[model samples]
Target: MAAVNVALAGRSYEVLVGSGLLGRVHCEAYSFLEPYGQRSIPVVADANAKRLLGEHLQASFRSAGLSIDWYEVPSGEASKSWAELEKLTDWLLDRGITRSDHVFALGGGVVGDLVGFACSILKRGCGFVQLPTTLLAQVDSSVGGKTAINASAGKNLIGAFHQPALVLADTACLASLPIREMRAGLAEVFKYGLLGDAEFFARVDADSNAILSHDNTVLESVITHCVGMKARIVAEDERETKDARALLNLGHTFGHALEAETGFSDTLLHGEAVALGMVLAARFSARRGLIAQSDAERVADALARAGLPTEIAALGLDCDGAALADHMRNDKKAEATTVPFILLRAIGEAYVARDVELADVGTFLDEQLRAH
Candidate 1:
């Protein structure tokens, strides 16, 4: 059992990572929820997660004499819409959830983001705990306080910075994930190494197979490492006012645009889009002589080794560079006509590039599209 503490001044919390955490919720999770008093807790989950782990989770809570009220949403990106948000909040209100009560978010990113946002706006604000079931959620979204729903403009356009009271990342929950989702999660794990830890990236390169196979030791270590990195960054700059925390968005600018191009559907999972986006960032960095072409190739090779998509061309979208680049204009990091990009100076060294020209980006992407 490894724990990473996110120091947010008075709002600090611990992220617990290990196997069999859900099964031990009675003993391990009781301390965290004790502060809020033992009552009927409301758990917001996606349909798939509810079906997979709901019974066990409820049993664990019940073992501790805690009652659970389950609320499920349809699983997918579409569930993070305004309509769903209204429905969830209305349900919580009807169930008598107050600002003093704690809400449990028990699923992947979509459920976490929606529930977090719901908690954020409920009677000004309420507390919530993140019980992330997906690898992508455990390693990335679950750790960060950033929560949001997609809008007509772009992904995560409507959201807030509501931190979770505690995060329980149970490695055992990942055993049921499909190989494709597991591979997608690895993209974010790889991003942590690419952005700041060259040695970690090398380890991932060598142990990609074991990591993908759900080796318990490797999974816990990797999740702990990523959580530790994110905790430090969030503590330093909780709202992304400084560039320190923005480094976490190493591939997000490019990835979010690709997500919009794909209609934020199954055509391209967020992690898959990020895998290809990181490759694009690397290639663009190499083009500008910021990094060696070999380094760029290594980035793509690492993702490919994990069975992740490394090229936008593979998606075969009927769009050009201009269309993709236009989607980025709606990105949260964009300021007027300039969008800040997290580009690499070398392997494990990333920096914010705010002087990017969208037209030039479009031209480069056009070439990438044509190559396929």
Candidate 2:
């Protein structure tokens, strides 16, 4: 087991990465739930995950004298909605939940985001724990406190920085994930290296196969390193007042555009969009002379090699580059009149570029659409 701490002034919490944690939750993660003193623990899970893992989790909790007050949402992007949020908050209130009780968010990012947001606004504020069951959530979203639901304008537009009280990333849950989900998670894992660490990127480039095959040692080590990197960056810039935390959005700006183009459905998973977005960012940087075209293709190769989509043409997007660029205007990182992009200087060094014009971005994306 490896523990990485997200050390904030008074909000510090540990992100525990290990095997079979959910089975031992009432004992191993008992500290986070102990505050409510044997009260039935509230758990909100992704519906499919409930179908797959609920019985086992329930058996473990029963053995430890804990009862689960359960609520489940459908398993997809649509679950992060105003209707779902309202339903979940009402359920918590109906359960007579108090500010002292911590809600456990199981399954993937959708569950975590919804539960975290619900906890953040519940009776002004309540505590929640992140039981991230997906590789994407474990390595990125579960620790950052950037919880949100997708808005009509854009993805993650309605959200807050309400950090979780604790995070237990059970690596074992990954055994049940579909191959596509596992590959999608690799996209986020690749981001940490793409933004800053060449050595780590190289490691991923070499170990992608091992990680994909469910090599526990490699998965745990990779998860720990990615979580540790995210923890440090988030701690340095909790609310993104500075640009440090923004660096984490390297592929997100373009990725959001791709998501909007697809209507934010499972037609394109979040991490797949991010994977393509990072490739676009790299190629865009090369187009403007920020990096060599060779390095840009290498970025695409790395992600593609790992089974992530690296080409925009494969998406068969009907809209033009201008349309995609317009979608970016709704991005949260956009300033009064500018949409800042996280561009690459090299394979592992990314920077925020605010001077690029929206029209130029359209033209560049046009070129990408035409290339291959």
Candidate 3:
């Protein structure tokens, strides 16, 4: 087992990455639930995840002589809507959850985001734990404390920074994941390397095949490292008031736009959009003389090697660059007239560029959309 701690002055938490973590949650997170002894544990899982991995979690609770107060989150990004949020809160209220109680969020990013947000606003900030079942969630979304539901305006525009008390990233759950989803999760894993660590990027670039094959050693190492990096950044900038946390959005600014264009559906997964988004960000940086063209292509080549979509033209979207750029006008990162981009100076070195003009973005994206 490997553990990384997110150090907040008064709100610190631990993220554990390893195999069999789902079976260990009852022991690992016991302290949080100890205060409310003998009460049935409140756990909300993604419907699909419940079907697949519910038995493991149920056994964990069963061994502790506890019963699960279960709720099922509808599958997909749609669950992060106003209607679903209302439904979740109503259910929690009826379950008699208190601000002092803890709720367990199971499954991938969608479940984590929805339940984390629901807990944040439930009785004005209750506690929650993240049992992230997907590679993307286990490494990124589950650790940052950035919880949200999607809005008409944009993805994650409606949410809060309510950190989870504990995060158990069970590597075992991933063994049965479809290869497509596993590949999508690798996008976020690769983003960590792109954002800060040059050597780590090279390592993953070389070992992506092994990582995708569910190599247990490689999987746990990558997850632990990503979680460690995230822990350090989140500890430094808890609310994103500083640039440390913002740097973590290396691919998300452009990724979110692609997602918005796709209606945030299965047409493009979040990590897939991020994979393409990082490619665009890299190429755009090279265009602006921030990085070399070869470096940009290297980034694209690395992601493509892992079977991710690395080009915008391949998406075959009906919208042009201007339409995609228009989607950015309401991005969560948008200021008066600019949407700050996380641009690369080189591989493994990303920085914020706030001078980006949306019109220029439209022109650049138009070039990408037309390129092979």
> Which number leads on lDDT?
3
Model 2 per-residue lDDT tens digits across residues 194-313: 999988998998999988888889999999999999999998999998888899998899999999999999989999999999999998999999999999999999998999999998
Model 2 global lDDT (CA atoms, 0 to 1) = 0.90
Clashes of 2: 0
Q: Which regions in candidate 3 have their CA more than 4 angstroms from the true location?
A: none
Winner of 2 and 3 under lDDT: 3
TM-scores, each model vs. reference: 0.98, 0.98, 0.98
- Order the candidates by TM-score, highest first — what do you get? 3, 2, 1
Q: Give residue 362's error in model 2 in angstroms.
A: 0.6
Q: What's model 3's overall lDDT?
A: 0.91
Clashing pairs in 2: none
Q: Which is superior by lDDT, 1 or 3?
A: 3
Q: How many residue pairs clash in each candidate?
A: 0, 0, 0
Q: Tens digits of per-residue lDDT for model 1 on 307-364?
A: 9998788789899999999999998878888899999998899999999999889999
Q: What TM-score does candidate 3 get on C-alpha atoms?
A: 0.98
